[model samples]
Target: MALIQGQSVDSAVRNALPPRNLGDAERLVSGALGAVVALWAIRRGGLAGGLATLAGAAMIARGTSGYCPVTETLSAKPAERQIARKQGWRSAAAAASSVTIAKPVEDVYRFFRDVANLPRFMRHVESVTVIDETRSHWVVRAPLGRTVEWDATITEDRPNERIGWRSDAGAQVRNIGWIEFRPAPGGRGTEVRAAIAYEPLAGQLGRLVAQLWGEEPGKQAHDDLRRLKQVLETGEVPTPALRRADADAAMPDAA
Candidate 1:
């Protein structure tokens, strides 16, 4: 019987309205609380108690119907636009890092081009599965034991030069990134430049959570590049044990 603005009184049009944002868990919890309150009010057995019971019953109905008038009223267009802007800022976030490795450009390029090798130096990456010649599936570890997966297609590939990739549609975390290899001056080694842009799973909130846990993306990229350099230079990533051994060996023996 309710009429929507600029619309006819048809069931089909009414059904097409935006769905309630309340998740299943929220509905279940609200309904349970409302039922308990309603039972308590009924036990009081008076005129005021009757009004309280009706209110509680209304709450149960709202939860069951997946419609909260207060929530809908608060989620007006202006609030929606503000949320969109926040998410957009997060989606456009990016980080870049560069490192010079004591290895030839061809060798470095070949190592990176093989996506499977990424997990060796990328601490957050759990695995990278090659789907085909130009496609790969990546799984990265997230906070609280969560893992995010995405399929990426190679957008650009030039042997010993550069490679670029973008995630496919519906990816859990949308992303695009590129890596370039250049010969260092005097053929000393390869200079690798990498950049990535991604939309965090929970947008800015997710990023802030990561930063709070000392896992910002920029810091991760910097450390990953350092690990890559160490791997290429020494055929192994440097560990605390290695550093300790090196320091001990450098110290003169106490007489």
Candidate 2:
């Protein structure tokens, strides 16, 4: 078991690294191709045009081979994971933040069960639709507040226990998460746990913003729960279930 887990971790590490299989000749060929395109563009157009083509060709080579030399040289070492704690990623931002809700199991379950009720506590979520009994469409506001949409199918729906969901292929913000509701140890309240995994959009801007605004995601989760607890315990209007139904009813049917 130890050996298998070790190999699995190694495999994941290797997959994270850009391929270095290309020989020196291949690297030269890529550079030469970039040069050629740039030269042609310069002759036909100008320096600015030439530079643009050269950049494009360089991107193509790096992307096609999956070996970006720049990334290889600048990439940071992967963080060592604690033997007892296995979560988060060195390459991508990951965290599991949880909060307790002082509510009954059925009320909490009903609140989360309705897709339209998401905006109440889901800060990044813009809209949600119940396409059918276990499937839904979601338009989530991206990290930097851009609108991203995705379709998701609910997996596990154990009443008062847990709810699991995974985004379909077409989802803009691909994610998988489980919301678990467990009775408080002393029967005081319900303990809510959420574990989510996702990969953000691919781009330099996305990477930079993710790194810069790293704490915001976790903070949002915390704030969302605080707000949710307030709404659920206080009978507020921003409940996830109410928000969804309101949005759905407001939309007109297609002509």
Which lDDT values do the candidates have, in the order given? 0.81, 0.69
Count of backbone clashes, every candidate in sequence: 0, 3
| Local distance difference test, candidate 1 | 0.81
Measured against the true structure, the TM-scores of the candidates, in listed sequence, are: 0.61, 0.55
Model 1 spans > 4 angstroms off:
1-90, 241-255
Candidate 2, residue 198: the lDDT equals: 59
Backbone clashes in candidate 2 total 3
lDDT of 2 by residue, 81-155 (tens): 221123232233334677777887788888988878878767677788889999999887655657778899998
Candidate 2: list runs displaced more than 4 Å: 1-92, 143-145, 203-207, 211-215, 237-255
Highest lDDT model number: 1
